[model samples]
Target: MGRSWQGRGRGRDMEYDKGGDNIGGASLKKIETEKGVIARFVIGRSANKGDSMDKSIDAENSQTDDFIILDNVVEAPEEASKKVKLFFAYAADRWDAQFYAKANDNIYVNMDALGSTLAAHLGKPRAYIGCMKSGEVFSEPNQKWYEPEWWKFGDKKAYFRHAYGEMYVITNALARFVSINRRVGSKKMGFQERTPLMVAAMYGSFGVLTYIISTGRSDVNRVSSDEKVTAHHCAVSACFVSIVEVIKILLDASTL
Candidate 1:
């Protein structure tokens, strides 16, 4: 069986039936159907910037219908999309919702306003309602969001008009779609970042690091491109549960 998703704004919810994966772009008629990705508006922490990030900080950070908070998600990003993916699974499984969103632990949402916003989309099938953003496909190796398979595309700037990640709604239809075809989205985007494996090891995000290792996309012993350190060295430098779990996992993977 095939899976399908709907897009809000100007796009239509194209129905699929075990036929093809739509990865965006006209030349690539099929893209992988990602599962467990429903829809969410999230709270985020402000972090470093990629040079391509737009400079209109004032317009982006302002409160609007798209943001569940006072800032656009792209500006104040959330924790990794993995965490939000899990949130989508849990919320969709346990409750019946027209749309779902995620906020930081410290943020509060107005239920009344959210309910009203969702009301407009009740009839929209598989509707994902969020402020859509089209970002550059980072292709350079060892950089953040570097799509290892960038050569598949004719041009990065061209595909920007197609599929994007930041959707913010989920209905029964969307949840069922996720249940059927969900898997990890980015195969290697963060795997070779400013040394993400090392960052995860040092920051005590053992869970994130473990997933990276499990993918067979990372080399535990390889030194980072940016920090010039191995995962083991970063694990040793960290002070927390990471010193135990991260180190052991790294050692085990290194031997394997």
Candidate 2:
């Protein structure tokens, strides 16, 4: 008598034989018969499901063109491949949806895994900055509502957005990240002695502007070297309705 197999998962499907030939201690449930010999049979416990299922069951070719049963494993190529490629697909989809619609199909790397792996590959400071800029947020949940900084690779100080006159609203996640990560506050040597707070304000990243000021990383009245203009000046000059919230943050900070 062979041991009875109990499948795991909420609705896992498992096939077995009622009374097939016993091979060793396991029963041989022949999937196919060719030349009077059994074609395929299962031999081990099913693989546990995790982020990826470890293929534990073993089956042998019984003689079926439609399906290949290794030990007792019968898997459709599409189904099996999806399990293996789940994370990769998920990461790629997120990156695509958030950043570039045109290059979505071009990306093949697994961003979920890439977030961890790439961080390890980069220098300590750079790795941290890289993941943050890429919007990976390893420590925090990358939820839709938890918007991250719009910063990206090579835009270390968010200079490009300011230089090109682009504006954004920073999210709570980005605010927390910058507020907690002190190293990110280090100002870069640029044409304008614009602190991260100044850059955030200039680009109209209200959440970041508020956080930087509230965290005391920047003096609300701090001015740029070139123009001597403060965050308040920038918000007023932008004159966009979206900047209204940023203006409120700046005004409140100035009073403090």
Candidate 3:
């Protein structure tokens, strides 16, 4: 609860937009005791990534100076691993902080509960808390989640699972680890068997579908292996989240 911020990869500063705790209509029980923060509040400014430091959004807590920010960054978990490395590489200004936590939007964190959990590992300099998940990687070429330099694990099932809606926490030390030391690998181009628009329509990945369509890369009219099956066909076939929205997006993309 100090200054808010925005940031991207390492060596850049971030600035957070202050809209109070409630965003849109979804609000969380306002947190009082503070140790960690919502990762979504973190953001970046400035085109120049040099000096790696910039400005901070004025959060509620004026007395304490804990939170920091960054520069230009993609959406979460895209360059997320790099964000971790950047935070760690950064030295605290004016004060000493024992821990740095990562939390973001779509969460209602009990700061008291989180504080107690973090207290147990207070003295340990390099302590890690929360769940660390793998096998979260997918090699969708034109998709945003694809990381070309995935050298953390051997082959498939290497990248940490990325759920855009899923909110979790992590410590400063661990986030800097593999993100900094991992090697880079050659990205092999492969043919996509199915259309993203079709797949997104079939499954209820509203965000992914919207992004793909916005890029104008998805061929909504393109048929699948069956040649007769189009994205519209898939949208109608699946009774998942309202097909109306998916169809609307497909139709809109068609006009573009």
Candidate 4:
């Protein structure tokens, strides 16, 4: 007699087969926010199964007409791209604002007095003040008075005082630039000489004034040196040279 299929538990076997089919049907889902689209793919346990599932999933999950995919990666739309660009642009602008704020603070701290002197002398309706750090004044004849005469015989206090005198001279030169230009009735002027004022103020010498004026840079019209005329000695002339170069560049760019 042949064994009955039912007696062999074929009904239980069918139930197990149905459960296995349910597991194979489980899928991984991908959703795109912008397009409001959903993609579903079957999950597989083996490499071959995974490969088959990938092909099936890709076919079922193809991008809609409004969306695009390149090399299995989503590409941003024009609007989204524009938004990203705007975000970076805003960030850069904010950074620049912060940088300028810090720079203005530094200018106020170190160069406020010098700036004020320049403004007063320039006599322009408006002026932008800038600062530079200078070293000891040059030893040239025009710069001798501003340069310390007795560097070899000073204590620390005397040395510091001498240095401060040089700083004052530099400030005076900046002031002189403004004053001479204003007197000439030129709002936009080129470089001018402040060496005479610097020399007379520091060394009580009027002869150096003629020498500085001979250089053909503008000189203050007043020839007499008295209480009203004062000069500040500069310790380091190199600093002025650099500042001049920077100003020239800025002026040229503004013209362009």
What are the per-model numbers of colliding residue pairs?
7, 12, 25, 8
TM-score of 4: 0.14
The lDDT ranking, best first, is 1, 3, 4, 2
- List the candidate 4 regions with Cα displacement exceeding 4 Å: 1-129, 132-234
Please tell me which predicted candidate would have the highest TM-score against the true structure: 3
Candidate 1 residue-wise lDDT, 198-243, digit = tens: 0000011111110011111111221222233234323433432332
Instruction: Give lDDT tens digits, candidate 4, residues 77-161.
Output: 2122222222222222322111100011001111222232333333221222233332444444566444445454343312222
TM-score of each: 0.35, 0.16, 0.36, 0.14
In candidate 4, the residue pairs with backbone N, CA or C atoms under 3 Å apart (3 or more residues apart, or in different chains) clash, namely 135-236, 136-235, 136-236, 137-235, 137-236, 169-232, 169-233, 201-231
- Give the clashing residue pairs of candidate 1, or none: 2-18, 21-30, 21-31, 22-31, 23-30, 23-31, 35-182
Among all windows of 10 consecutive residues in model 3, the one with the lowest summed lDDT is: 206-215
lDDT of 1: 0.31
Query: Residue 112 CA error for candidate 4 (Å)?
Result: 22
lDDT of 2 by residue, 168-244 (tens): 22222333333344233222211111111111111111111100110111112222222333343345335444534
On lDDT, the candidate that comes out on top is: 1
Q: Residue 57 in candidate 3 has what lDDT?
A: 30
